[model samples]
Target: MKKTISREALKSASLEYNDVSGDFNWIKKRRGPIKVGQKAGSINHAGYVVIKIDQMKFMAHVLVWFLKTGEWPTLDIDHINGIKTDNRFQNLRHVTRSVNLQNQRKAHPNNHTGLIGVNKKGPKRFLALIQIDGIQKSVGTFENAIDAHNAYIEAKRKGHPGNTL
Candidate 1:
Protein backbone atom coordinates (compact mmCIF):
# COMPACT_ATOMS: atom_id res chain seq x y z
CA MET A 1 0.00 0.00 0.00
CA LYS A 2 1.09 3.56 -0.76
CA LYS A 3 2.04 5.53 2.34
CA THR A 4 0.27 8.80 3.15
CA ILE A 5 1.42 11.67 5.33
CA SER A 6 0.02 13.17 8.54
CA ARG A 7 -0.34 16.89 9.16
CA GLU A 8 2.54 16.93 11.64
CA ALA A 9 4.73 15.05 9.23
CA LEU A 10 3.82 17.48 6.48
CA LYS A 11 4.73 20.38 8.71
CA SER A 12 8.04 18.77 9.63
CA ALA A 13 8.69 18.07 6.00
CA SER A 14 7.94 21.70 5.16
CA LEU A 15 10.47 22.94 7.70
CA GLU A 16 13.35 21.07 6.14
CA TYR A 17 12.46 22.72 2.85
CA ASN A 18 13.11 26.12 4.46
CA ASP A 19 16.39 27.66 5.49
CA VAL A 20 17.21 27.37 9.17
CA SER A 21 19.47 30.41 9.25
CA GLY A 22 18.01 32.46 6.44
CA ASP A 23 14.48 33.75 5.96
CA PHE A 24 14.04 32.15 2.52
CA ASN A 25 14.36 28.48 1.64
CA TRP A 26 13.49 28.21 -2.02
CA ILE A 27 16.38 29.68 -3.97
CA LYS A 28 17.17 28.55 -7.46
CA LYS A 29 20.50 26.86 -7.50
CA ARG A 30 22.66 27.11 -10.62
CA ARG A 31 20.06 26.22 -13.23
CA GLY A 32 21.30 23.25 -15.15
CA PRO A 33 20.16 19.95 -16.59
CA ILE A 34 16.44 19.97 -15.79
CA LYS A 35 14.25 17.95 -18.14
CA VAL A 36 10.93 16.22 -18.39
CA GLY A 37 10.50 12.61 -17.17
CA GLN A 38 13.72 12.85 -15.15
CA LYS A 39 13.96 13.00 -11.37
CA ALA A 40 16.88 15.31 -10.66
CA GLY A 41 17.75 15.54 -6.99
CA SER A 42 20.11 17.93 -5.25
CA ILE A 43 21.22 19.22 -1.86
CA ASN A 44 19.77 22.65 -1.22
CA HIS A 45 21.63 25.36 0.70
CA ALA A 46 19.29 24.54 3.59
CA GLY A 47 21.36 21.35 4.03
CA TYR A 48 18.96 18.79 2.65
CA VAL A 49 18.77 16.82 -0.56
CA VAL A 50 15.51 17.21 -2.52
CA ILE A 51 14.45 14.55 -4.93
CA LYS A 52 11.43 13.91 -7.13
CA ILE A 53 9.63 10.63 -6.58
CA ASP A 54 6.83 9.31 -8.75
CA GLN A 55 6.56 12.60 -10.64
CA MET A 56 6.07 14.63 -7.46
CA LYS A 57 8.48 17.36 -6.40
CA PHE A 58 9.33 17.57 -2.70
CA MET A 59 10.84 20.71 -1.29
CA ALA A 60 13.29 18.65 0.79
CA HIS A 61 14.20 15.17 1.96
CA VAL A 62 11.85 15.52 4.92
CA LEU A 63 8.94 16.20 2.57
CA VAL A 64 9.65 12.90 0.83
CA TRP A 65 9.91 11.30 4.22
CA PHE A 66 6.47 12.64 5.00
CA LEU A 67 5.19 11.20 1.74
CA LYS A 68 6.52 7.86 2.83
CA THR A 69 4.89 8.13 6.22
CA GLY A 70 1.63 10.02 5.72
CA GLU A 71 -1.12 10.97 3.30
CA TRP A 72 -0.76 13.88 0.91
CA PRO A 73 -2.47 17.11 1.86
CA THR A 74 -5.83 17.57 0.16
CA LEU A 75 -5.31 21.19 -0.87
CA ASP A 76 -2.53 22.64 -2.94
CA ILE A 77 0.16 24.67 -1.17
CA ASP A 78 -0.40 28.33 -1.95
CA HIS A 79 1.59 31.45 -1.34
CA ILE A 80 -0.64 33.75 0.68
CA ASN A 81 0.90 36.72 -1.05
CA GLY A 82 1.13 37.12 -4.81
CA ILE A 83 4.51 35.51 -5.19
CA LYS A 84 4.49 32.49 -7.43
CA THR A 85 7.66 30.60 -6.43
CA ASP A 86 8.13 31.32 -2.74
CA ASN A 87 7.67 28.02 -0.87
CA ARG A 88 8.16 28.89 2.78
CA PHE A 89 5.64 26.94 4.84
CA GLN A 90 4.55 30.00 6.75
CA ASN A 91 3.85 31.59 3.38
CA LEU A 92 2.19 28.44 2.20
CA ARG A 93 -1.28 27.16 2.98
CA HIS A 94 -3.86 24.65 1.87
CA VAL A 95 -6.49 26.70 0.13
CA THR A 96 -8.87 26.42 -2.77
CA ARG A 97 -8.00 28.41 -5.89
CA SER A 98 -11.07 30.58 -5.55
CA VAL A 99 -10.26 31.47 -1.95
CA ASN A 100 -6.73 32.27 -2.90
CA LEU A 101 -7.90 34.48 -5.73
CA GLN A 102 -10.33 36.22 -3.40
CA ASN A 103 -7.57 36.94 -0.94
CA GLN A 104 -5.51 38.59 -3.66
CA ARG A 105 -5.51 42.26 -4.54
CA LYS A 106 -6.41 43.40 -8.01
CA ALA A 107 -3.38 43.30 -10.25
CA HIS A 108 -4.97 44.24 -13.53
CA PRO A 109 -5.02 47.86 -14.51
CA ASN A 110 -7.76 49.50 -16.64
CA ASN A 111 -9.81 50.05 -13.48
CA HIS A 112 -10.66 53.72 -13.90
CA THR A 113 -10.99 56.06 -10.91
CA GLY A 114 -8.71 53.59 -9.12
CA LEU A 115 -11.86 51.69 -8.26
CA ILE A 116 -14.95 50.25 -9.88
CA GLY A 117 -17.04 53.14 -11.14
CA VAL A 118 -18.77 54.44 -14.21
CA ASN A 119 -17.55 57.46 -16.12
CA LYS A 120 -19.94 60.27 -17.07
CA LYS A 121 -19.77 63.53 -19.06
CA GLY A 122 -16.64 62.50 -20.91
CA PRO A 123 -14.98 61.14 -17.75
CA LYS A 124 -15.46 64.41 -15.90
CA ARG A 125 -16.99 62.57 -12.95
CA PHE A 126 -17.60 58.99 -11.96
CA LEU A 127 -20.63 57.31 -10.48
CA ALA A 128 -20.05 54.11 -8.57
CA LEU A 129 -22.47 51.25 -8.78
CA ILE A 130 -22.06 47.68 -7.63
CA GLN A 131 -24.01 44.54 -8.35
CA ILE A 132 -25.09 42.48 -5.41
CA ASP A 133 -27.22 39.37 -5.78
CA GLY A 134 -27.92 40.25 -9.40
CA ILE A 135 -29.13 43.72 -8.44
CA GLN A 136 -27.21 46.80 -9.42
CA LYS A 137 -27.12 49.36 -6.61
CA SER A 138 -25.65 52.81 -6.91
CA VAL A 139 -22.94 53.35 -4.36
CA GLY A 140 -22.51 57.09 -4.91
CA THR A 141 -20.95 59.70 -7.16
CA PHE A 142 -18.08 62.08 -6.68
CA GLU A 143 -16.79 65.18 -8.39
CA ASN A 144 -13.26 63.77 -8.17
CA ALA A 145 -12.29 60.30 -9.34
CA ILE A 146 -10.38 59.57 -6.17
CA ASP A 147 -13.35 60.34 -4.00
CA ALA A 148 -15.53 58.11 -6.13
CA HIS A 149 -12.96 55.36 -5.78
CA ASN A 150 -12.85 55.83 -2.03
CA ALA A 151 -16.60 55.54 -1.89
CA TYR A 152 -16.44 52.36 -3.92
CA ILE A 153 -13.82 50.98 -1.59
CA GLU A 154 -15.96 51.83 1.42
CA ALA A 155 -18.92 50.09 -0.13
CA LYS A 156 -16.73 47.07 -0.85
CA ARG A 157 -15.53 46.96 2.73
CA LYS A 158 -19.07 47.04 4.08
CA GLY A 159 -19.93 43.54 2.81
CA HIS A 160 -19.41 43.80 -0.89
CA PRO A 161 -15.97 42.39 -1.21
CA GLY A 162 -16.89 41.18 -4.67
CA ASN A 163 -18.57 44.38 -5.73
CA THR A 164 -17.32 45.99 -8.90
CA LEU A 165 -18.90 49.19 -10.18
Candidate 2:
Protein backbone atom coordinates (compact mmCIF):
# COMPACT_ATOMS: atom_id res chain seq x y z
CA MET A 1 0.00 0.00 0.00
CA LYS A 2 1.09 3.59 -0.70
CA LYS A 3 1.53 6.08 2.14
CA THR A 4 -0.03 9.55 1.98
CA ILE A 5 0.72 12.55 4.18
CA SER A 6 -1.75 15.20 5.15
CA ARG A 7 -0.91 18.88 4.84
CA GLU A 8 -1.06 19.40 8.60
CA ALA A 9 1.19 16.41 9.17
CA LEU A 10 3.62 17.70 6.53
CA LYS A 11 3.73 21.10 8.19
CA SER A 12 4.40 19.41 11.48
CA ALA A 13 7.30 17.61 9.87
CA SER A 14 9.22 20.91 9.84
CA LEU A 15 10.48 20.69 6.29
CA GLU A 16 12.03 23.65 4.50
CA TYR A 17 10.90 24.18 0.93
CA ASN A 18 13.28 25.33 -1.78
CA ASP A 19 11.37 27.63 -4.08
CA VAL A 20 13.88 27.33 -6.92
CA SER A 21 14.15 23.57 -6.95
CA GLY A 22 10.74 22.81 -5.48
CA ASP A 23 12.28 20.28 -3.09
CA PHE A 24 11.68 19.94 0.63
CA ASN A 25 14.63 19.70 2.95
CA TRP A 26 14.13 18.14 6.33
CA ILE A 27 14.61 20.74 9.06
CA LYS A 28 13.65 18.45 11.89
CA LYS A 29 14.67 14.83 11.85
CA ARG A 30 11.76 12.66 12.87
CA ARG A 31 13.26 9.22 13.59
CA GLY A 32 16.66 9.28 11.92
CA PRO A 33 19.61 11.14 13.43
CA ILE A 34 20.47 13.34 10.44
CA LYS A 35 21.68 16.89 10.08
CA VAL A 36 19.05 19.60 9.93
CA GLY A 37 18.40 21.37 6.58
CA GLN A 38 19.69 18.30 4.76
CA LYS A 39 17.85 17.37 1.59
CA ALA A 40 15.43 14.60 2.41
CA GLY A 41 15.09 11.35 0.46
CA SER A 42 17.04 9.71 -2.36
CA ILE A 43 16.18 8.91 -5.96
CA ASN A 44 14.91 5.38 -6.29
CA HIS A 45 16.00 2.99 -9.07
CA ALA A 46 12.92 4.03 -11.03
CA GLY A 47 14.16 7.69 -10.95
CA TYR A 48 11.39 9.01 -8.68
CA VAL A 49 12.35 10.62 -5.37
CA VAL A 50 11.30 8.78 -2.20
CA ILE A 51 11.18 10.32 1.26
CA LYS A 52 10.88 8.29 4.40
CA ILE A 53 8.71 9.77 7.16
CA ASP A 54 8.72 7.82 10.39
CA GLN A 55 8.17 4.23 9.19
CA MET A 56 6.25 5.10 6.03
CA LYS A 57 7.81 6.01 2.68
CA PHE A 58 6.16 8.46 0.27
CA MET A 59 6.84 9.73 -3.22
CA ALA A 60 8.15 13.29 -3.19
CA HIS A 61 5.98 14.42 -6.12
CA VAL A 62 2.82 13.33 -4.32
CA LEU A 63 4.06 14.93 -1.11
CA VAL A 64 4.75 18.15 -3.00
CA TRP A 65 1.18 18.18 -4.31
CA PHE A 66 -0.14 17.66 -0.79
CA LEU A 67 2.05 20.44 0.55
CA LYS A 68 1.05 22.90 -2.16
CA THR A 69 -2.67 22.10 -2.28
CA GLY A 70 -3.23 20.92 1.31
CA GLU A 71 -4.96 17.90 -0.19
CA TRP A 72 -3.94 14.56 -1.61
CA PRO A 73 -4.08 14.13 -5.38
CA THR A 74 -6.88 11.79 -6.39
CA LEU A 75 -5.24 11.23 -9.81
CA ASP A 76 -1.72 10.65 -11.03
CA ILE A 77 0.79 13.50 -10.62
CA ASP A 78 2.33 14.07 -14.04
CA HIS A 79 5.57 15.91 -14.70
CA ILE A 80 4.68 18.37 -17.46
CA ASN A 81 8.15 18.25 -18.98
CA GLY A 82 8.25 14.45 -18.87
CA ILE A 83 11.38 14.44 -16.75
CA LYS A 84 10.84 12.22 -13.75
CA THR A 85 13.22 14.01 -11.38
CA ASP A 86 12.12 17.57 -12.20
CA ASN A 87 9.78 18.02 -9.22
CA ARG A 88 9.37 21.78 -9.47
CA PHE A 89 5.78 22.68 -8.56
CA GLN A 90 5.29 24.47 -11.88
CA ASN A 91 6.31 21.31 -13.72
CA LEU A 92 3.74 19.16 -11.98
CA ARG A 93 0.01 18.72 -12.50
CA HIS A 94 -2.76 16.32 -11.57
CA VAL A 95 -3.97 14.46 -14.68
CA THR A 96 -5.74 11.32 -15.67
CA ARG A 97 -3.62 8.38 -16.86
CA SER A 98 -4.81 8.76 -20.44
CA VAL A 99 -4.14 12.50 -20.60
CA ASN A 100 -0.80 11.98 -18.97
CA LEU A 101 0.18 9.41 -21.58
CA GLN A 102 -0.76 11.82 -24.35
CA ASN A 103 1.91 14.30 -23.25
CA GLN A 104 4.70 11.74 -23.24
CA ARG A 105 7.96 12.03 -25.13
CA LYS A 106 7.70 11.22 -28.83
CA ALA A 107 10.21 8.41 -29.06
CA HIS A 108 10.97 5.43 -26.91
CA PRO A 109 14.30 3.60 -26.52
CA ASN A 110 13.31 0.91 -29.01
CA ASN A 111 12.34 3.34 -31.76
CA HIS A 112 14.49 2.77 -34.85
CA THR A 113 12.36 4.56 -37.46
CA GLY A 114 13.33 7.96 -36.00
CA LEU A 115 9.69 9.05 -35.95
CA ILE A 116 6.98 8.41 -33.42
CA GLY A 117 4.11 6.13 -34.61
CA VAL A 118 6.04 5.32 -37.80
CA ASN A 119 7.50 1.87 -38.29
CA LYS A 120 8.94 -0.17 -41.10
CA LYS A 121 6.31 -2.20 -42.85
CA GLY A 122 8.70 -3.63 -45.48
CA PRO A 123 12.02 -2.85 -47.10
CA LYS A 124 10.56 0.20 -48.89
CA ARG A 125 7.26 0.76 -47.07
CA PHE A 126 6.54 2.51 -43.74
CA LEU A 127 3.41 2.21 -41.64
CA ALA A 128 1.92 4.88 -39.41
CA LEU A 129 -0.27 4.03 -36.48
CA ILE A 130 -1.77 5.83 -33.50
CA GLN A 131 -3.40 4.62 -30.33
CA ILE A 132 -6.38 6.46 -28.91
CA ASP A 133 -8.36 5.32 -25.88
CA GLY A 134 -6.41 2.04 -25.94
CA ILE A 135 -7.40 1.37 -29.55
CA GLN A 136 -4.79 1.34 -32.32
CA LYS A 137 -5.75 2.85 -35.66
CA SER A 138 -3.66 2.76 -38.78
CA VAL A 139 -3.04 6.12 -40.38
CA GLY A 140 -1.66 4.76 -43.66
CA THR A 141 1.39 3.22 -45.29
CA PHE A 142 3.96 5.37 -47.05
CA GLU A 143 7.12 4.99 -49.09
CA ASN A 144 9.03 7.19 -46.63
CA ALA A 145 8.99 7.23 -42.82
CA ILE A 146 8.61 11.01 -42.75
CA ASP A 147 5.36 10.93 -44.74
CA ALA A 148 3.95 8.22 -42.51
CA HIS A 149 4.98 10.20 -39.44
CA ASN A 150 3.31 13.29 -40.89
CA ALA A 151 0.05 11.41 -41.32
CA TYR A 152 0.37 10.10 -37.77
CA ILE A 153 0.93 13.64 -36.47
CA GLU A 154 -2.11 14.97 -38.35
CA ALA A 155 -4.27 12.18 -36.98
CA LYS A 156 -2.94 12.77 -33.49
CA ARG A 157 -3.65 16.54 -33.67
CA LYS A 158 -7.22 15.90 -34.78
CA GLY A 159 -7.77 13.18 -32.17
CA HIS A 160 -5.97 14.70 -29.18
CA PRO A 161 -6.46 18.24 -28.01
CA GLY A 162 -3.42 20.24 -26.86
CA ASN A 163 -1.06 17.63 -28.31
CA THR A 164 2.28 18.79 -29.65
CA LEU A 165 4.42 16.97 -32.21
Candidate 3:
Protein backbone atom coordinates (compact mmCIF):
# COMPACT_ATOMS: atom_id res chain seq x y z
CA MET A 1 0.00 0.00 0.00
CA LYS A 2 1.12 3.57 -0.68
CA LYS A 3 2.09 5.71 2.29
CA THR A 4 -0.56 8.22 3.25
CA ILE A 5 0.16 11.84 4.06
CA SER A 6 -1.50 13.54 6.98
CA ARG A 7 -3.61 16.69 6.64
CA GLU A 8 -1.30 18.66 8.98
CA ALA A 9 1.73 17.81 6.88
CA LEU A 10 -0.09 18.72 3.70
CA LYS A 11 -1.05 22.12 5.14
CA SER A 12 2.49 22.80 6.40
CA ALA A 13 3.75 22.09 2.88
CA SER A 14 2.01 25.30 1.78
CA LEU A 15 -0.74 23.50 -0.14
CA GLU A 16 -3.81 25.71 -0.07
CA TYR A 17 -7.28 24.26 -0.58
CA ASN A 18 -10.15 25.72 -2.54
CA ASP A 19 -13.42 24.53 -1.04
CA VAL A 20 -15.42 25.64 -4.06
CA SER A 21 -13.37 23.65 -6.63
CA GLY A 22 -11.97 21.03 -4.25
CA ASP A 23 -8.46 21.64 -5.60
CA PHE A 24 -5.09 22.20 -3.91
CA ASN A 25 -2.61 24.90 -4.87
CA TRP A 26 1.09 24.45 -4.16
CA ILE A 27 2.92 27.69 -3.41
CA LYS A 28 6.09 27.22 -5.46
CA LYS A 29 8.85 29.43 -4.08
CA ARG A 30 10.43 29.98 -7.51
CA ARG A 31 7.16 30.89 -9.25
CA GLY A 32 6.58 33.71 -6.76
CA PRO A 33 3.42 33.90 -4.66
CA ILE A 34 0.27 32.79 -6.47
CA LYS A 35 -2.99 34.70 -6.31
CA VAL A 36 -5.49 33.65 -3.66
CA GLY A 37 -8.00 30.96 -4.73
CA GLN A 38 -5.87 30.02 -7.74
CA LYS A 39 -6.36 26.41 -8.82
CA ALA A 40 -3.42 24.04 -9.14
CA GLY A 41 -2.66 20.46 -10.23
CA SER A 42 -2.42 19.14 -13.79
CA ILE A 43 -4.94 16.99 -15.62
CA ASN A 44 -3.54 13.51 -16.11
CA HIS A 45 -3.99 11.27 -19.16
CA ALA A 46 -7.06 9.71 -17.57
CA GLY A 47 -8.57 13.15 -17.01
CA TYR A 48 -7.93 13.12 -13.26
CA VAL A 49 -6.12 15.98 -11.56
CA VAL A 50 -2.71 14.98 -10.20
CA ILE A 51 -0.55 16.91 -7.77
CA LYS A 52 3.10 16.16 -7.10
CA ILE A 53 4.37 16.42 -3.52
CA ASP A 54 7.91 15.57 -2.49
CA GLN A 55 8.32 13.74 -5.82
CA MET A 56 5.22 11.60 -5.12
CA LYS A 57 2.12 11.87 -7.29
CA PHE A 58 -1.30 11.96 -5.67
CA MET A 59 -4.71 12.14 -7.27
CA ALA A 60 -6.48 15.39 -6.45
CA HIS A 61 -9.72 13.62 -5.57
CA VAL A 62 -7.93 11.27 -3.21
CA LEU A 63 -6.20 14.26 -1.65
CA VAL A 64 -9.55 15.93 -1.30
CA TRP A 65 -10.82 12.86 0.50
CA PHE A 66 -7.95 12.98 2.94
CA LEU A 67 -8.34 16.72 3.43
CA LYS A 68 -12.06 16.46 4.16
CA THR A 69 -12.09 13.30 6.30
CA GLY A 70 -8.58 13.51 7.79
CA GLU A 71 -7.98 9.91 6.69
CA TRP A 72 -7.20 8.00 3.52
CA PRO A 73 -10.12 6.39 1.74
CA THR A 74 -10.32 2.60 2.07
CA LEU A 75 -12.22 2.10 -1.18
CA ASP A 76 -12.19 3.68 -4.64
CA ILE A 77 -12.93 7.38 -4.88
CA ASP A 78 -15.75 7.70 -7.41
CA HIS A 79 -16.77 10.84 -9.21
CA ILE A 80 -20.53 10.62 -8.62
CA ASN A 81 -21.36 12.88 -11.56
CA GLY A 82 -19.24 10.76 -13.98
CA ILE A 83 -17.11 13.77 -14.90
CA LYS A 84 -13.55 12.75 -14.07
CA THR A 85 -12.27 16.36 -13.84
CA ASP A 86 -15.07 17.58 -11.59
CA ASN A 87 -13.42 17.12 -8.20
CA ARG A 88 -15.93 19.05 -6.14
CA PHE A 89 -16.39 17.43 -2.73
CA GLN A 90 -20.13 17.27 -3.26
CA ASN A 91 -19.60 15.26 -6.50
CA LEU A 92 -17.26 12.71 -4.97
CA ARG A 93 -17.84 9.52 -2.99
CA HIS A 94 -16.02 6.41 -1.78
CA VAL A 95 -17.57 3.28 -3.25
CA THR A 96 -16.76 -0.27 -4.20
CA ARG A 97 -15.49 -1.07 -7.71
CA SER A 98 -18.82 -2.58 -8.71
CA VAL A 99 -20.73 0.43 -7.44
CA ASN A 100 -18.41 2.75 -9.31
CA LEU A 101 -18.92 0.87 -12.58
CA GLN A 102 -22.68 0.96 -12.08
CA ASN A 103 -22.74 4.75 -12.21
CA GLN A 104 -20.64 4.96 -15.39
CA ARG A 105 -21.70 6.76 -18.52
CA LYS A 106 -24.75 5.37 -20.31
CA ALA A 107 -22.75 4.23 -23.30
CA HIS A 108 -19.22 3.78 -24.52
CA PRO A 109 -17.89 4.95 -27.85
CA ASN A 110 -17.80 1.42 -29.20
CA ASN A 111 -21.38 0.69 -28.30
CA HIS A 112 -23.47 0.32 -31.46
CA THR A 113 -26.83 0.11 -29.73
CA GLY A 114 -26.30 3.41 -27.93
CA LEU A 115 -27.38 1.82 -24.65
CA ILE A 116 -25.47 0.11 -21.87
CA GLY A 117 -26.09 -3.60 -21.26
CA VAL A 118 -28.28 -3.89 -24.35
CA ASN A 119 -27.36 -5.70 -27.53
CA LYS A 120 -29.15 -6.68 -30.67
CA LYS A 121 -29.96 -10.37 -30.73
CA GLY A 122 -31.83 -10.18 -34.04
CA PRO A 123 -32.79 -7.68 -36.67
CA LYS A 124 -35.77 -6.45 -34.67
CA ARG A 125 -35.05 -7.68 -31.16
CA PHE A 126 -32.69 -6.56 -28.41
CA LEU A 127 -31.39 -8.43 -25.41
CA ALA A 128 -30.82 -6.87 -22.03
CA LEU A 129 -28.27 -8.20 -19.57
CA ILE A 130 -26.38 -7.18 -16.42
CA GLN A 131 -23.40 -8.40 -14.49
CA ILE A 132 -23.70 -9.32 -10.83
CA ASP A 133 -20.72 -10.58 -8.90
CA GLY A 134 -18.91 -10.98 -12.20
CA ILE A 135 -21.70 -13.16 -13.56
CA GLN A 136 -23.76 -12.05 -16.50
CA LYS A 137 -27.50 -12.42 -16.02
CA SER A 138 -29.99 -11.93 -18.77
CA VAL A 139 -32.82 -9.52 -18.01
CA GLY A 140 -34.87 -10.40 -21.11
CA THR A 141 -35.31 -9.87 -24.83
CA PHE A 142 -37.46 -7.03 -26.14
CA GLU A 143 -38.66 -5.65 -29.45
CA ASN A 144 -36.98 -2.28 -28.94
CA ALA A 145 -33.76 -0.92 -27.42
CA ILE A 146 -35.67 1.27 -24.99
CA ASP A 147 -37.42 -1.72 -23.43
CA ALA A 148 -34.18 -3.62 -23.22
CA HIS A 149 -32.40 -0.67 -21.64
CA ASN A 150 -35.24 -0.30 -19.13
CA ALA A 151 -34.88 -3.91 -18.15
CA TYR A 152 -31.14 -3.47 -17.77
CA ILE A 153 -31.72 -0.39 -15.65
CA GLU A 154 -34.14 -2.27 -13.46
CA ALA A 155 -31.62 -5.04 -12.94
CA LYS A 156 -28.87 -2.52 -12.15
CA ARG A 157 -31.07 -0.77 -9.58
CA LYS A 158 -31.72 -4.11 -7.88
CA GLY A 159 -28.14 -5.39 -7.87
CA HIS A 160 -25.83 -2.38 -8.11
CA PRO A 161 -25.22 -0.11 -5.13
CA GLY A 162 -25.30 3.70 -5.53
CA ASN A 163 -27.37 3.38 -8.71
CA THR A 164 -29.13 6.72 -9.29
CA LEU A 165 -31.46 5.56 -12.07
* Number of the candidate with higher lDDT, 1 or 3: 3
Best candidate according to lDDT: 3
- lDDT tens readout by residue for model 1, 46-130: 4444554344545543353233336454544445554444434454566555444444344236654444444442456678765
Clashing pairs in 1: 4-70, 4-71, 5-70, 5-71
- Against the true structure, candidate 3 has what lDDT? 0.82
TM-score of 3: 0.83
Q: Using Cα atoms with residue i matched to residue i, what is each candidate's TM-score against the true structure?
A: 0.44, 0.80, 0.83
Question: How many steric clashes between backbone atoms does each model show?
Answer: 4, 0, 0
RMSD of 3: 2.6
lDDT winner between candidates 1 and 2 = 2
Q: Who wins the TM-score comparison?
A: 3
lDDT of 2 by residue, 1-165 (tens): 456766777778777767689787988756657678888888999788888775688888888888888878898898877777778888888988777777765667687897889989999999998998779999999999999988988898888764533
**Which segments of candidate 1 are over 4 A away from where they belong?**
1-16, 19-79, 83-86, 92-98, 107-122, 131-136, 160-165
Per-residue CA lDDT of model 3 for 12-87, tens digit only, reads: 7668777887777665442545554456778999899987776688898998888888879999899987888788
Question: What is the full ranking by lDDT, best candidate first?
Answer: 3, 2, 1
**Candidate 2: which stretches are off by over 4 Å?**
29-34, 106-115, 162-165
